[model samples]
Target: MKKTRYYPFERNRYFYGKLLTVRDFESEQKYFNDKRRMMNRLLHGYGVLTGLQVIAVDDKSVSVEMGAAIDALGREIVVPSPMTLKLSMMDGFTNNEYAKNVYLCIAYDEKDKEPVHTVANSSVRSDEINDYNRVLESYRLFIREDAPDPASLPLAGITDQTVVIYQDAHVRVLQTTPRYVNPGQLFEMKLRFEKTLKAGRLSFSYEMASERIEAIHGATIMFQEPQEQLESEYEIKVLLRADSTVNVKGTVGVKEESAILKLDDCQLDLQEQAFGEIQIIKEPVRERLMSDFVKQSLEASLESPSEPCIYLAKICLIQMGPTYVIERVEQVPFGEYVFNSSVMYRLAHSAEYRDETAGQFVTKSKVKTLAPGRPPEFKVNYNPAMSELAFDVGIPVGGGGGIGGIVSGVVDIPIEPFTKINVSPFGKPSKSFFSGEIAHGLGEGNVLILTSLEETSVDSISDMLANGERVYGGSSDVFKGSEFEPEAPEVKIGTIAYPQKGTFRIGVKLQQPSEPFDVRVRWWAYSAETASSGSSSGGGDRLDEALSALREAASAGSDAE
Candidate 1:
């Protein structure tokens, strides 16, 4: 059996609070003044933080101790390490009543699950408190319904009763594991709901607006005597489509309650993952047949004796994030190579990285050139936490002089220049402007830039490499000293921003060269960490085994070749 490695796919829980309307902020004399005051209040009080605990819960009310607030006993609560708290603003909805309407999104982690304390000995009845389960069963929300004023009728009325809205059931579509999904990916869509009616039979059906998506199993589900808290699941496969909204509709029927369940407008966004940019520059070397005798001997040893030249391709993986790794690389020939063939398709070898250090990221690789006729193989090791990729490349060379039928000489070419390519993210707030010394040791070389506007996958680029076609050529933006050349340079760089993140393929093509040139680049990248629990944040025991498996795969594939 062929063993495949799987990285941990983490799904974060997202709790979106209902739109909050601060009455005073909404009724300010001036719009701009209201906005300013509201923002100041929110920042000082209701912003996102970790360790916000549930202090009290009842049928009619629920209270929370904010991360920054003091507890009832007046001692400070323990605070956990904080993550990014993204809050959505609704100032654009000016026509509405309130001056500010914002929602709170907590990227909930299961590791933060702590037993919530309930107010037990209060005067409230147990049955009514048990009915509090009704509130917990639905999409949870916490409202600070403090008396609008310390003296405002105590906000009492028929409307003041916290109404528990009831229906047949409520369904929420969720990608629990990843919180987000990529186009053309197989993902699980979990539907969590409660059976409001105890003794009713319900049938469910789902449909996606786009034809590019299909349900793995039939999309219909049936429930008999469904429990109070029940969960339904479906595996959905989606294909790449232009940025558009997809509606996942679910219809349900229940006879006893005379209720018809229609879950409409359940949106599944169709967007690509954000991938970084890659630039590849190559220095080509021409093959010299030393002598007729040498050429003849080399030809006889190999089935196909084409002059195999040495190729040195320098690649830059650029992003705003800390670091990245090259997970996999493959090479295949598109057409037959004659003795005078100008270009050879070469794919850098695959490797993995484990971010062992707390802050710094390191990249290291080893390359071994086979015989004169074969292309080299690359072995890479890197840190996964900082980033997830590294490239290893080999250049084949053989002895030129022969003494007593023994080829004698050594071609020692050092690898891992490991230059950085610093580039800005593509759009505004864009990090696209790149200025640097083209090559360190070799002095100056022309810089070529191009944009991969379309979302492309590593698999697609690997196919291009395997096909041995010229894809990175044609007109390009070139910078040589103070002068600018509109014509394409020998190499090109492609940038893919977020919503387009994927395995980026960089193709380097160089025509016949009489001498050697230098290839170099350096890059830096950063991605905000969301969840910190489990293995998502670091490189663990599986890294070594994963790399070993990769090497075994490479060896088995090479042996087959």
Candidate 2:
């Protein structure tokens, strides 16, 4: 979009004993007038300043009220009285097949006339001749097929002479719903008109290129009951079912009387199911062991321990089909070293030991010797009867004759498949130690363990899971197996209303013998007289003052010349 450029004025120069002609005087007057017009264009811009409302006069004409505006060339246009425009006289109305859009516009015009003036002879009685160029400003109103572009209007040519004030398009399609759809889904298309239809019946029909997709219901919709009272909007719904996965392509046609209007092509895709796989491991894949420093510290503090030592273990159980498998096991260290002597003695005597070479516990003696002669050994076992995994750590205590007794501490962890658990030391606040889906079906993807001090955090995590979002925290925390990615949905569905602003456009097909309609136009006009004195008008005020000074100086120079 380009605006008209006004060049700086070159006024006539005056010198001592110089002759001035009619052309020189006319040029001098033009300089001041051009300066003022240029100021109006730059400072105020141009649009309908007030009134100029378009109202429907009848089925074939509309009336425009009196108003004022400034054209693109900075010429003021004012309408003194109301005017009526007929639809039949508008351009492109006779050549249109279905409906024609009409635009009402106004343009600036001027005329020069020579008026007869009688002059009386005074003293000398000699004939003196004088000529005057009397100019009259006027305006012209007309109707056209296209609306004028305000920024690119012709200022110095006759091609485009008017600025559009209103437009009227009889019918429009508001929206189409569910552009993407699953198999056997329903689709809807909605349309709106400027006014109620006078026809008795409206029919709907569809055509599809693919044989897999078929319309089960609403294929041919008919609205015939009380046609005189039909609404401005009509919604056509079609139930389409796809026999196989494919892209559905089709078009819908609406028929009113003898006229038929075909809509744009409709595109839809059928969604397919995506499944994931589950892998079960018979043996443990990973193990987390305690540090040597933690082990030595626990044994050293057992000399005069006041409380029982507590051992923490984090275990993850994954469900495959019916049974569950222990995928990972981690041992956590106790922050402080403490032991119960009496409790340790009972665990040391009752706990069974496991032989590392046999992969099973020794049956003959409940106690197994460690390091050929030393008494310290770990006893690990899983009991199905109680559904618990127990671990016993023993240390040797010196005696009088080189025979020492074993001091052992036991930690029993409860295991319930697919359930969360909270763990803490005795007399300490409980914290979330395990979280997983309870009774989750055979389908498998990955297991995620989220440990936090607050239990309420689970609500937000559960919401994410429900929304089909992947909840894997990181590589270390996620026990990944195998998975499949789901397909994206194809169509979106919604509704839209009329008189909207922005780049979104609506299309429509009108019935035969289309009715005349009128549109309400909204315009913003800025002028120096109507401008307010406020913070918002500060910049405008400064520009107005500067332009006023330039116009005054040009007027003074033109008068002196």
Candidate 3:
């Protein structure tokens, strides 16, 4: 926005006993008038102060209501009565391919009239004609291809003198409800026309960048001859999604007579979501192990091991074969041995024999055995008188001579068997394996163990990554689809100020042989407190006072001279 410029007031200088010529008097008058005009321009600013309503009278003319305005040079422009302007009589009203913009503006003109006498002498200036420059203010219509320039004045001597009352275009924007909205939210805009839409196919649509917004309903409306009266106003509605945040330039347009006319254009800001809440569902897990049996059994029994448990046991037995003496032999008794302990065991025994033929019989017998156990104590009951000693001992043939052989014999007997066992806890295992189990369980819809739980925050749904292959399960209300229907927005209708200062614009575009229509314009202006006090005679009273003071000063000067 550009800033308004400030102008200082020019005042006259006075001195004691100074010669006063006609030029000096004129300069004094100019000083006072310029001071007052400067105050008006500086304090109130230049624009229509009241009542300049414009109404279309016909296809080529319009009626303007009586009004008042201040020109750029601080001059008051008053229209005492209503007036009419013809479009064909205005400049730039010739036919063209496109429509032209017509502006009702204040035009400034000056004329040399109102003759007055400079001196009261009898014959000094007889038959002479002197006049004062009179300011004439009237309204004029300017037709152009575009809106009037704000930076450029209408003429060299004029500043904001060309106060535009109104301009005629095809369509004009009235109001927009909720100039901004979140994505996927609905908003509405209203538009007005200066002319009735012709009986034809009328389509309504909003034009914007793709993915920014979409029309849900009310995009098109058909107008028949009977419906032409209802075409003065239109409403456009559109929806913006929640996932999009880019600002959009939306243009609402109407199609008629094979031509598209823009009704309203505006920039809407989309409020983006700062963060989104999300709940993550984890996959299930399952595992199997040998320790599960033991653990379950122990749990059922309500028992647990306090320390490591180990046990070892061993037992062995051996027997000797029956012995016989050679030559003068006597019978020999059999013997047996047994052992049992935590370490190696040995057995040793002796047997006696007597000879009967040679009065002295010599017989000897011995037996020995060793194994992984304690040695055994032996007690024998034998008689020397008996020809042979008898005992309950049995021996097998083909037995090895040493303890190694005896131990080998027991090896085939399966004395004490050696076995190994491993124990491990159930369920706890590698993470990758657990994950695989979870995934497998998810597919089969079986009972699973939860491996992990996670959550994340994102600005929008677009920022989240989706992996279809991974298993997911849970419910979330954040991204759920809505079931209720969207509510319709309220209607809004009003006039908008034009880019050109102090003016309201109305537009219309229709097929050839367009219908006669009226333009409605609402406007406001700047005014000082005294001017806006609703006093109808205040301005006339002030003017009269100034004129009377001027006459009294002139009379005094004439008498002094």
Candidate 4:
């Protein structure tokens, strides 16, 4: 690189002088390009020099341009313009020797018309030891030629060049031109392919918080040969959703296949132009739990009409938010907004769970004009809106002495299950099971149940054999055991259902209850929602206080009977 340096001689006055004894004009002529005019001025007694101008500077040598000026006396004089002087030879110029110093004084002749009175001693000193070293260090290297190489001729008869493909591709983000960008400014992202890859295509995806946007700079791009060897630049523009940082994640894959070639996580830092502060902050999604208590007294009266079973039943109401609310919130392609709540029922006369409003409940109202209809069943009103119902038993299945047993069956009940199985050492083994069907009441959805058998003792055994590796199970508790297959593993069973409304059955049978075990049953329901999908029938009811009053009514009816 050609480096240039500047040295300022802050003299106010200027004059013309000529070299007295130095003889390196040939090297000096290389910079000015015209040797005739310089020599003619020297011959005419007009060559004069005063200040030094830096012409070139490098680690090896410093080239300075020496110049002359009309003296401050306001006298008009014809003199040679300053020319670049290449200073390479370094000797004892400091000792004031003529061989090393280029002394410049006004060139005078005995036959001159007017007497030229000018000092012959204005010289620019060159300290190649200290001053020149500083120039070398401070000089900015100049860029000379940067023309792009012309495209090469294609290989004869070859349609596409087969670049050798290597697995496990790694890429380095070479440069993000204009790392700090305005909200809508276009920026360039340069990625260097560190590993060779076959002819493939590159795709880009941008994520700002939870929102995902496509790269304006063509999301999908085909590879151009030889470009694989050099850094590739892609132009990207983000609008509307701007944040402190935008993650630009991408994957590269072969042109014809679905296999990914590389996964690159790149980020664009932002310099935001803040307009105002946030006025009101609210959660992206709001949730409410709506429970309906249905009195079994009505069903009992309709069925037998002899003995009435007047206990209140619990029902769950799952409904979607109003259309305007869903529209106001941002939605991603495959993203979901989930609100969850669980429902359990307890009768007033049950001793296991004492009801606070036991004796005060009323099964029949004396001032009732008409009997109210029974509450709807626990059906999922929203279709294609996924729901996951998990049943978990908190107990450690102490390692089985031998191969553990597997229990697989189905439980069919009219409503949700109310069974709790107790297999603890100190407690009585109470076997409970409940089966129910959820009439999705809509079309097109899936119900998936995933049952995983996790052994807590695995951690103890793993820690004994563990090295420096960490076991992470999505929790902060480091001592928690990782999920592992046990010698006495519990039986794993599940069923899948498609379509909106379907019947489901569940069955649980304990072989031996010596080792306390934990069981978790999860049910996933997805309901399809569209812009035209209307709200379900049973929704928008607050049930916290209503549940209490319903229990009191049932207790009062039981006491009166």
Candidate with maximal TM-score: 3
Q: Give the TM-score of candidate 4.
A: 0.15
Candidate 1 C-alpha lDDT tens digits along 1-561: 111111122223335873444443343323443344333322222222233333213211223333432111111223343322211111111222221111211211113233443456235764443212211111112221111211121111111111111222222222212112223345443332322121223343333222333345543433232346422222333222222223222211112323233333232222222111111112111121123224453212221112111101111111213322211111110111121112212211111122333445456554433323344577665766665446677654442211111111111221222223333364212112222211111112211122221112345754676632222122222233423232222333332222222111223222222133332221111111101112343443444454354445434333111
lDDT of 2 at 107: 66
Instruction: State every prediction's TM-score relative to the real structure.
Output: 0.20, 0.27, 0.29, 0.15
Of 2 and 4, the candidate ahead on TM-score is 2
Quick one: how many clashes does candidate 3 have? 13
RMSD of 1: 35.3
lDDT of 4 at 463: 62
Q: Residue-wise lDDT of candidate 4 within 27-59, one digit each (tens)?
A: 443334223333232222111233323322332
Error of 2 at 149 (Å): 6.3
Off by over 4 Å in 1: 1-50, 53-205, 210-365, 378-391, 395-561
Error of 3 at 110 (Å): 3.7
C-alpha lDDT (0 to 100) for residue 145 of candidate 2? 39
Q: In candidate 3, what residue range of length 10 has the lowest lDDT sum?
A: 432-441
**lDDT of all predictions:** 0.26, 0.35, 0.32, 0.26
**Model 3 misplaced stretches (Cα beyond 4 Å):** 1-6, 19-47, 53-63, 71-75, 84-87, 90-92, 95-103, 115-133, 136-207, 210-227, 230-561
Write model 3 residue lDDT over 122-163, tens digit each, in one string.
Answer: 357666645454544444434443333221331211111111
RMSD of 3: 62.5
